[model samples]
Target: MNFLDGILFALFAEADKSAPLMVPDSVQKANFAETVRKLANLDVDQLLQNLLSESVWILIKVLIALAIYFVGRWIVRRIIHLLDAVCERRRVDVSLRSFLRNTVRVVFTLLLVLIVVSTLGVNVTSLIAVFSAATLAIGMALSGTAQNFAGGVMILLMKPYRIGDYISAQGQSGTVREIKLFSTVITTVDNQTIYIPNNSIATAIIDNYSTADVRRVDWTVGISYGDDVDTARRTILGMLAADPRVLREPAEPVVWVSALADSSVNLTVRVWTKNTDFWDVFFEYNERFYKELPAAGINFPFPQMDVHVKNE
Candidate 1:
């Protein structure tokens, strides 16, 4: 009994000497216990059960987002339509409408994508930064195509020429068959297809012959120096008169000595005719002049080297 009492005394002494371990009083202890119970984490099964309890909320949020998107799409379409109507009222070019519509659609779709990403808790700024960097690379890589695109825009805006117009542009002479956003497609008289870069065509001089109803036809006929100029001129004039396709009353066809060459005099015969008939008149008139000049005592000149052999 004495040993037991001594041990008990030592335990009490040690407990007394140590700092007091604070514990909540009865009321605070009950409150803390209750709070812990309230704040206790749910098990996975419980969490899943809670989520599945009412999917209506999630669906509602998604539906709202989708509704907003659909409404926005409708609004965008309406806006595009309005833009076209306004353009039509204002007499805007057809090409302008296509460019504007495409731009609007792209911009609006980008906006929609941003909204959707933001809804999904994704950072849009980072995406935009990445896209911007990627776009810079793409733009640099397609610099030549971009130049052609800009050239196409300039071509459309400046109204230098249009489809179905006969033109000589960018070292190409043909009828403009298609004026696309990147290049102009042309069909030559010989049925050759020519694709001219829009930028090159935009920067170059464009000769639109179809703008005029009549085109001047020039015929050059060379005669031996000894041939009578007056008689040759009259004969050429008579040949032109025989062709009914030639235009008259352009103050009489001009027949003048154009040049004095090494062995012949070149006569310039210029007349006007319908643009469509220009080629036909050119070839026919040339053929007639060739046949008639010899009959009219006019000698056509040729390259001749007089060789004098020295007697050795």
Candidate 2:
């Protein structure tokens, strides 16, 4: 179908026509044995010289190809090193730099291999055609992986989230550990590792907690209806002000009665803190509320039932 295939077919057809098959009789067999013995008895020096004269150029070419391969491989490594240095100098993101360096190395190695094959008298064009066909078939078979790869490239270029950033995407939340070609590696708070396909992450909503310098922490606490609402609110505000981790410039901590529940009054407390101190502030506040609320005579109300019994 293709030019190389047609050429091979024509060569095979000609060879088939020119070549003859012989069914030898006893006399012909005896003469063939005698001829083989005479040829074997020929001078060794003359045979060696003839063989060398015919194959010397081919042997030289093979050696040259081998030399080129070794030298080209060394050069490729040096080029890769130079590329790494350039990326380092430019202060590129580590993940993007690594991906680019690997891609460049693979491309250069492929080119070097093609050069070597061409030097060995192989048809480079035919090899390229075969490779292209195979690649196309593989691409069709792994369309999902191809999409992930494309998404990974986009992510590396766009940088929606960087490594070490805590992000929630694709129904999972974790710190981004690595951004690979087809997937991203994440480590969760519970020390679990997850591999999320890049395509899913790229398409889904990404919640990056570390993108902002500060984050808001909300808490809702219930107090008995009989307790002093002003006292509870003042206690929480004083606690937030005392904590150095809570931010106060942009907006101060807010405490207000949010809702009147069936058994108690729900007081909402909102505070701002550094992103890194959000969890610490949250847990510490909860612990302190449990301890200090009781000391402040603030009763955490519980459900109760009142019943009256007559003549039963």
Candidate 3:
């Protein structure tokens, strides 16, 4: 007992001994002894016997509660597995799988917690009400996060680009490395990494270069005004044709007299090739055109100013 309780009990014992009823020393000692001695008396023993009778009921309650918790946990796991299987069966978007899995796991854990609390005789309806109120407050506090989450959900549901697709969006152009609910990861051509938030990505104009099987390579060639325009056109077309990477199925390369200036005529050349061969073919054709056109007696135009000699 605490010191205060000990002093109070001793004072009470002394007062009892001085009472006119005149209780004996032996009886007073029994009444004032430690709680352990008091509990060992016959009356206390009978009270304990009554409590032991109800102990079995408490054990049963504990076992039932434990069983509910364990079984509920098992059910939660099964639900998660079922969700994963459903996604696989429907060929659902992979970017959303991780998000859905985490959400489902948290929800199931919460449900299990609620069920266990209910089994232990907690007032679950009130608990739910309290949790809902708290959740509403939290939602208000993190409204920006809610908007991002909504955008993320939309991005996952409607995939604009998949992993490894070369894309340009939100002022960044790169090959998509990974797509998550919150952000889209991109690795640029120069190997620089960039992350675009889902909210911005969803609203921006996305240029997906990897979508098309073929990409057109565009280049402009300037020719001297005096050179044979017909010869230049034929030579450029021939170079495009000789390259196996160029797509002949789309017809021969288109060469047009796009622009005419005082010094030169600009010819625009467009060639179509498989996306994989785009860079290789474009570089090869540029080098070939620059080297071969001159050898073929076709003049490449350069800036020139004619200086008239003044005769005095």
RMSD of each: 13.5, 6.1, 8.9
Ranking by lDDT: 2, 3, 1
lDDT of 3 by residue, 113-199 (tens): 887788777899999999999989998997766776777788777778877789999889999876655677899999999988878
TM-score of each: 0.62, 0.76, 0.63
lDDT of 1 at 27: 49
Which runs of model 2 end up more than 4 angstroms from their true locations?
Answer: 1-74, 119-121, 303-312
Count of residue pairs whose backbone atoms collide, per candidate: 0, 0, 0
| Candidate 2 per-residue C-alpha lDDT over 1-312 given as tens digits, one digit per residue, 9 for 90 to 100 | 644454346434423344347634875577567666755775778656766765886798899999999999999999989988998899988778767776788899999999999998899999999999999999999999999989999899888998889999989999998887789999999999999999999998999999999999999999998899998988888888888999985789999899998888999999999999999999988999999988888999888677888995
Give me the displacement of residue 185 in model 3, in angstroms. 1.8
**Candidate number achieving the greatest lDDT relative to the actual structure:** 2
Count residue pairs with overlapping backbones in model 1: 0
Ordered from best to worst TM-score, the candidate numbers read 2, 3, 1
